[model samples]
Target: MSIVRYLTHPQVQIDPDVPVPQWGLSPIGRARTEALAQASWLARTTQVISSGERKAIETAEIIAIRLGIMIEIREAMHENDRSATGFLKPAEFEQVADQFFAEPHLSVRGWERAIDAQARIVREAEAVLARNRPGDILFVGHGGVGTLLFCHTAGCPIDRVHDQPAGGGNLFAFARDGRQVVHGWRRMEEVAA
Candidate 1:
């Protein structure tokens, strides 16, 4: 069975002035991705699919370059649209995120509704899986939509409790054939361990 892994980008250079999707990976994020490129588990990943967001593209590029593969960018795979609020402080974002998850059907402050985000992510994943290619597949994206995909694959409710850790750079794997979750979230570095 092929393994399909979804990895969230690590820390990003968060700039309120820049559009969230345009934010690039911070130094820490680059270093983490560089290290992740060395993971033996990634050896089988023949396809690298990434969210169109800059941070995610940067993260995917590092691994794809090392694996000698080109990345396929999916714009619709972006994080839940928080463009309505533009940017929010950490505390504010967290609070809003909580509400976003708690009320899946209701949009929070113009942000995309949790239910809608889940549907989008699930659609994206299923579309790629339908290709039915050989070897493992790697999906590089943001934590928000990554969590949405994870929850769906795990057969769990859409909730923030299944979210990645605070600093991001986490991953979850599922079997491509069955869409069966092999594991929940784990640090990127721990993928091969």
Candidate 2:
């Protein structure tokens, strides 16, 4: 069966001065993405796409280079627009994130509504899959919307309980045709072909 993988960019360099969308991967994050490139399953990816944000793009670029492939960037694949609050410290961000998942229908501190972000991510992913019939497709993006998409594909409720673990660099797999989740979130290195 055709399979699609969605991966969240690994940890990022937290630069309060830099726009959150512009912040690239941290040194450790780059190392993590590079290490993930060695996964056997990544070699099978025929199409690679990423959110327009820097971190996601950086992560996608690393994998693409390893596989000798090109990356397609999609703005709709961006993390839920937390631009309302800009960059919050990790501690504060977690609190806001908790509320975001808890109330999917409501805007958390003027951030993009969870429901809205889910819709956008789902729509973009569907459109991408419709146009590409690759044997294996990979989407590199953020954790928030990734969890939302994962919930939609898995036929689960939009809840943070479905979210990936505390760090980034996690992934989920689904059947491209049926859109059924084949696997839950796991670190990139943990995935097998």
Candidate 3:
């Protein structure tokens, strides 16, 4: 059976003053994504969808162009809403993220609860899959919500242990029909056709 792949955008240009959603891909991120476009596995993707966030959109665009497919942006595919806290430094963000995963029910420092984000992601993903024709699909979004969705599909609990590696550019595949995760997170370049 074919698979649905969820990819997290790679490294982004960190501008402390900018809103997290507006931040785009960094130089290294662009380079890495361009390289990832060369992966043979990407040829299998017939449709590309992305979160409205700039970083994810940028990543999706790169892949879409390489695969000669148009991108469909979905607002619900966005990262866990962190607007309440704004841009926390990496160290501070990591601390809060740990809490977010540890207590899936509670909003850590005004961030969206992990369970809520998980529900939104799963719902949005299901909607996308239901409406589209059967084929390999690629969903480009953020790591936090991606992990939550992966946890759901894998029959695992919401935990950072299931999160993608730091710095992003990771993906996991799931069987399209039954929604069973075929594998854990792997770097984009590492996935085969």
Q: In model 3, what are the clashing residue pairs, if there are any? A: none
Model 3 C-alpha RMSD vs. true structure (Å) is 0.9
Q: Which stretches in model 2 have alpha-carbon errors above 4 Å?
A: none
Q: Candidate 3 residues 60-82, lDDT tens each?
A: 99989999889999999999999
Task: Assess the local accuracy of residue 158 in candidate 3 as a C-alpha lDDT between 0 and 100.
Answer: 97
lDDT of 1 by residue, 1-193 (tens): 8999999999999999999999999999999999989999899999999999999999999999999999999999999999999999999999999999899999999999999999998999889999999999999998989999998999899899999988999999999987899989999887763
Cα TM-score per model:
0.98, 0.97, 0.97
The C-alpha local distance difference test score for the whole of candidate 2 amounts to 0.93
Relative to the unseen true structure, what is the C-alpha lDDT of residue 73 in candidate 1, on a scale of 0 to 100? 97
Candidate 3 stretches with Cα past 4 Å from truth are none
Cα deviation in Å at residue 131, candidate 1? 0.5
TM-score of 3: 0.97
User: How far off is residue 59 in model 3, in Å?
Assistant: 0.4
Model 3, poorest ten-residue lDDT window?
A: 38-47
- lDDT of every model, 2 decimals: 0.93, 0.93, 0.93
